[model samples]
Target: MSDAPIRVLVCDDQALVRTGYVTIFSAQPDMEVVGEAGNGHEAVSAAQRLHPDVVVMDIRMPLLDGIEATRKLAGPEVVEPPKVLVVTTFNVDAYVYDAFRAGASGFLLKDSPPAELVAGIRTVARGEALLAPTVTRHLIGRFAERLRPADTARPGRADLVRALTARELEVLELIAEGLSNAEIAAALFISPETVKTYVSRILTKLGLRDRVQAVVLAYRVGLVTAAD
Candidate 1:
């Protein structure tokens, strides 16, 4: 790991919110506000130029929405895309799902406290998905229908399933069900570090960006259900 502070690009349509984020991140020893964008278009442009480790993206913005910006910045098609943390509202639940699908590393409620927002940025920068149990459930509950049942014979299904050891498959299910690392650890009688290692191996084998993508793929592949 580099010794530099985690570089962050803050994107929000509102100036006030941007200011608040800037203030919070600037004060953190582990974080630095490398750039700021008031809208999605600017966000994409800045990301290209700045190459920040993480982007704090707002869902609704002029010129381009955060989802689109997220796609351009962190979509699967992009090579070495930066991590994106979406900040939005419950009312735009569909957009939140789209943001995740667009390759956001995590979602943060717009009204989340300053501490949470800071922690979320750090989490993503650490290459971890910042999905709490509640966030996971909310995501699955609200957007489960959007995920079509996986055709078992789809291009990567067999490969994905075969790539995991039985233990990894079990961990994947717990993850899809929205269990945090510690929770999954307790349930499986394993250490949190071990759970994290399983998660890392799972992501590597499946070519997933983070746990958010892991959860998405789990539901898509029928390893875990929306009902769970």
Candidate 2:
């Protein structure tokens, strides 16, 4: 990682909320607010010009919405996409799934505590998706139900393991259950750094943005069942 502080762009239509997010990032010793955007159009432009390490994006905005902005900035076709952390009033339905599919590294609540906000930014900056335990347990389950697919449509469960080593697959299963790097390390009798490598490999092999997408893919591919 670079020695420079993590650069962030705070994007939200509401002035008060935007300023509040800037204040949170400003207070962090290792974070800097590079710029701010009041709408998604501004967000995409600032992201391209400033090239921030992370974009703290709000879902609703005046001109372009956060989902579309995220797509433009971090879509799969982009050569080097910046990390995006979606901040909103709530993680409701398609909003959460669509944001992740759009390439957001994580989803966070607007009212999240300052400490959590800081930790979240750091986590995403390190290339990990920030899936709050509460957010994952609740939202992911509902999302799975709403998106139930036919057996023929679902990718074969066995095919999911074709690219991953046994250890990597184990790490992925734990990740799908919402275990953090440290937690997964302890459970598997390995170091956190090793766990990070596995997570990175998983994302690369699956062409996913972050852990949120990994979890969704794990479920869809049948590596994990709803009972898990």
Candidate 3:
């Protein structure tokens, strides 16, 4: 548990969705609901004013959508940005790729259990990206398939790949394949705790803030192929 509470802003066009998140997040001792917005325009404004640690955003909204809002708030254009978590109903949402491209730290289904939602927020708040295996493959592999090989090949990215130990590299490939920690552990014949440790070490060695960044790095550096 963290010493300080993580302040959060909830954004969704549906009032019920916003209210539910407020109810769930407020129950956590280490989190607080600082504000709520009904649209992307309002979300952006509220984020700027409240400066919450995390923003729970919905993709479809009036005035602006979560994708654009995420871009404005956390995109490459922003020097300093708060973490944004895309909470939506779609399992394989088309906008997910755009959300990540726009700098979202994590993506979750709206129906996700409260525990996972809380974990996602905390993970992102701590400067770690949450790439649930399914979501990662759906976004990265699918997107890469549409790109040219030359575009995927990035110079110097191989240096980061070279930095990983054999074990860590194995973990990265499994992550690219969208295997859960437990699955990766089982496949690698190691304990789940060990897999977790390797994942953390991989992120640290690669200077990646989170799993989302790791997935991006894997794709950008051509560590994982779309066919894989």
Which candidate has the top score in TM-score?
1
TM-score result, candidate 3: 0.77
Clashing pairs in 3: 129-210
lDDT of 2 by residue, 1-228 (tens): 578999999999999988888887898889999999999999999999999999999999989999999999987677788899999996586788888777788888888888888898998898777886556655666565443322213455447556789898999888878788999999999999999989988877766666766777666667776665
Candidate 2 regions with alpha-carbon error over 4 angstroms: 141-160
TM-scores for candidates 1 onward, in order = 0.88, 0.87, 0.77
| CA lDDT, every model vs. true structure | 0.82, 0.82, 0.81
Ranking by TM-score: 1, 2, 3
Tell me the deviation in Å of residue 36 in model 1: 0.6
lDDT per residue, candidate 1, 99-134, as tens digits?
Answer: 877888888898899899998988888777777776
Q: Higher-lDDT candidate among 2 and 3?
A: 2
Q: Is candidate 1 or candidate 2 better by TM-score?
A: 1
Our tally of clashes for model 1 stands at 0
Candidate that beats the other on TM-score, 2 or 3, i.e. the better one: 2
